[model samples]
Target chain A: MKCWLLILLILFSQSTLSADFAVIVSATSGIDVLSSERIRDIFLKKRRFAQGKRLVPVNLLGSKPPRLAFERRILEMDRLNLQQYWTASHFKGVTPPATQASLASVKLFIEKVDGAIGYLPIEMVDDRVKVIYEF
Target chain B: MSFRLRVIVLMTVLSLAPYIVTMIVMGNVYRDDYERRIRDNMTHELDITNERIEQSFQSLRKDMAFIASLDTMDDLLTGDLDKRITNLLVLKKNDMQLIGWFDVIDTDGNVVASSNPDRIATSADSSGLFSVPIRSSFDDNQLGQLTIHYSFENLDRFLPESEHSHYHLIVEDQQVTGPLNTDPVISVSRVLTDWPAVTVTLEQERQFAFSLLNSAENLFVIVLLVGIFVIASIAFFVATIIVKPILQLSGTAESITQTQDYSQRVAINRNDEIGQLSHSFNLMINGMQDMISRLKAENENRIKLAKEKDRAEMLQDLSTKLSRYLSPQIYESIFSGEQDTTLGSSRKKLTVFFSDIVDFTSTTDQMESEDLTNLLNQYLKEMSDIALRYGATIDKYIGDAIMIFFGDPKTLGVSEDAKACIEMALEMQRRVRELKSEWGAAGYSKPFSIRIGIHTGYCTVGNFGTENRLDYTIIGSAVNLASRIEGQAEPGTVFVSEDTQLLVRDHFSMTPTSTFTPKGFSQPIQLFRVISSGVTRSEIVIEESGFSLKLDSQELTEAGRQDIKTRLLNLIDDL
Candidate 1:
């Protein structure tokens, strides 16, 4: 009975973890609806500008569900692959996205920074930030 | 104290006192200076350590601010998922040789990136010693803080620890670097300007701080002792040199006193004052020796002179006693070295004299022996006085008689000798007449009367005796003639032989008496009575068998003369 309960808790956590997340920017940024390839290029520092505006990207620390989903859906890379791509990009004078410890910090960074973008849980996003790409 | 001891003491005091004082004072000064220098050194080290800590903190702040301003630090928004900021922090830590962690903290106080990877995503345990705020490069907004979690061990390089000194980091009034030294010789603390709650302290141990001073003081003490020893030794040597000669001089003086020998002298071989003293002493000794010898000579001379004086006195006494036995002339001649005493005789013309007290034995028989002695002595003294006055040499004294002579030892011519002898007899007769009255007054109605006789002829006159016993008397007929004449003389009358009368007829008045023949004389000697002096003629004497008269015109007063004239006229009428 303990194992069944444990199994059910895992399933419920999985569903919650799989909920929708979005790439966000400040509401005043005037940037919106970025494509998944454009979002990947921006996060990887391959594209520094979007919609004639300089772009800044941010990431959550470690493998959170939103970051993983962002890497899988927007960058089309897994953790290992994205890490390799950033490593390669770093040598090329291109760095990976900035980091925040939590989705709240990511949302705050996006709201406070100009041309800034980061991935967070859709529930964490507010009127202060706008969604650029979804996963 | 003795001179050497005094000198040594004075020298030791004089030499060592200043040295010891200087050593002590200098030692104190050096100790103080060394102590001050040590303290200053500690302070300097503390200041340097504080400067280093401050510089390190400043460098750390500047580096943190620079790292915060880096675009790479913007990765904090992604929570450093790629570990970019962490990699940079690690590189900086290694490059700066930092011993502590560098961290990027979120505004929520969670560490997003750190030099220590394990600290990432964790809440910071403490506020860092140095911090800089992370600002968004795009918007210039402060996102989080860049900080260093400095281990006190990281400050160990700046805060040196050794046997002599130690360092500590004080945080909020707490020693964070091991245990704090409770008691230290020197302690200095400095607060960090960037981190007000942090302090750097340098501490020095008591033993280590004063070690140099202790060693310096010991060396000074050793030097002082050595100086004292050297001074004492020099003082002893100098004192011996000075005092030795003085001691020798004193010893010589003492010996001189004990032995009563002024010849002793001090022996010195120096050319200094002590040598001069010795030389003067020797000169004084020489003077004393000379004075003593002179005194001795003078004493010997005095003794010899005294002995000579005693002999002269004894000879004078012998001469005085012998003069009574001899005539003055003979005595003078003998003592004056003019004559020699010998048993010899000479035939020379001499006038001999004899005198006797008439009926001396018969008169004195009726008197006491004392009276007799007085009368006899008186008579002899008077006769001898008269004899001596006539320059007669008294020959001998017989019973109641005195034998005297003239012109033997000394003579005025034969005639003058006879005259002088007759004059002396007349004076004797006159003196006898005067003494008759004196004796009559002295209790004898029949006083003594003396009779004198004189003769002039050739006789043997000289010392006439054996070699042992000698007599200076005449031994010839002239002497017998003078004696027979004296026997025939009337009492209180002077009689002379024909020879004497003939020779003295011009100088004295004389009357011829009957001749007398003496025993041992071959011829009858004619005698004459010696009356008054012919030169004066002041007296006339008349004598006969039944009556005698004497008249002295000079002696008689007018009344006496008149009385005598009347008596004489009556007597002539009776005749």
Candidate 2:
């Protein structure tokens, strides 16, 4: 039975987590239903637009707890691993995502900046910042 | 290579061998470690790549599903297929690595839809369409077996190119659903059963080993170059310090030998074995020099001794000859070593006289041997005395004949020598007359007569000899004719040669004697008889006075006095 449980956990960990990154827009805004690939592209600076609107991506500081959790769940990168990744990114002149101090700061930035996108836990949901995609 | 260079190179090789080995070993270890790390990291990177691919596929699928679930998708599905294809074309154009999309096949093997009609070989075949059930909004009804083929290359944006395109996956296949390391990836298969048509896809992942080995190899090449340079420099320094001196010494020694300089010793300044060797070489040179000098000195001494001995032997031979034949007076005169007789020749005027006892041979014929020896000794002694007293030399004595000359084997003069000779001849005649008188008083009945001759002329007097011995004598025709004059005289006569009479023609009163053929002559010689009894030794008697001397009537007695008187007359005649 324990072997069965251990196998079950291994199987569970092997499965892709149903994490999503949303390229969200305001309810008053015009974009909807972005593909997770498009969201990844925009976050990684590989693309510049969602639908027709230019993407304005906001992020938390790399060392921030929420940022670490966000990268793990969405980008699927640990902090140490992300550090190495960004270090390589910095060499390419493709800066990692711009950072904010907190969820509040991200919300404030999203409200001010056009087409701004940010992420937070579901419980931190607010009306100001629109979640683009979730992972 | 020079010995120093070789030694330095060897030493450097020996010295650096360990480091070279260590570097090589470390390089290998690091290479392995780097390769291992790249592999381990590649595994994780590949996992991330797969997840991204899956994510991309899921998003593509969701987009397709959304389109299929859209009111337009249903409208297009029910309507012409061109509208649906146009929408998928738009989606495909959104990403670069993505090719055109395809629709899934149901279990009934029907192609529901596709972005590109060419994506399927045939509509009824459905071999390339996906048929797997995908999760959707309604778990009941099973999402109507909807499946979609994603372009699948959107993951390249996030992953490195080496890891992005070298893999493939099959999401619905359990054996290949996990992380992969190669191409033709199938992240999602729209198939419900094994026989269901499925979309086979490719993902991104390539081998990182090539780059890993390349970096290690590059690092190794660079390190090796640096290591070789460092080793060479160290080797050069070592050789310069250690081996150069020994080489110099060797060449120096070679030069010394070639130069044949045994005394050329090396001078090594260092306090080492070579220095000691140089010192020893100097000592050996000194010893050799000393031995050579000693030998040279000894050789020189030996030569000097040999020359001195030859000189001494010559002197001894000369001394022995001197002692054998020389009288004391002559020895002293001749061997004084300062006197020179070897070149003794002189022109001098001299008077020569010759005399012979008349019939002395017959007188000795009957005498006893003792009486004859006594008589000859007395005669010779008395005649020699008279010759010496008148400053004349007894030139020779031939039996009872006497020859005398005044002037020297030693002196050089003319007129004085002639005068002295005349005086001596007169004295000789006088002494003979006195001797005859004494013999008569002793009553020896065998009377002897002497004949006398006198001449005056220039003569050469010096030593004349054969190879072995020499005699000092006067040589001239003057001496020869004087002997002739003596022989021509009668038993009581004293005669003078014409040569003498000519010199004293007016000064001497001479009676012309008869001419006669003489011995050893082809012609006759004229002789003169000079009167001589009034001649005295102290008086310069003039021959023109015509003096005569009185004596016994025996011819021997009368000839003796007459010879004395004739010599005085000859002196006054001034020849």
Scored by TM-score, the top model is 1
Candidate 1 off by > 4 Å: A1-135, B1-294, B541-549, B555-560, B571-575
Per-model interface RMSD values are: 5.4, 18.5
How far residue B263's Cα lies from its native spot in candidate 2, in Å, is 2.3
TM-score of 1: 0.47
DockQ of each: 0.13, 0.01
lDDT of 2 by residue, A4-108 (tens): 689556544643564423334454445556666676676677777777887666676445655654565556666677678778887997666655545655655
Local distance difference test, per candidate?
A: 0.81, 0.58
Q: Candidate 1: lDDT of B89?
A: 97
Ten contiguous residues minimizing lDDT sum, candidate 1 chain B: B178-187
User: What local lDDT does model 1 show for residue B115?
Assistant: 92
Across residues B398-429, which tens digit of lDDT does each residue of candidate 1 receive? Answer: 87889888886888999998888887887777
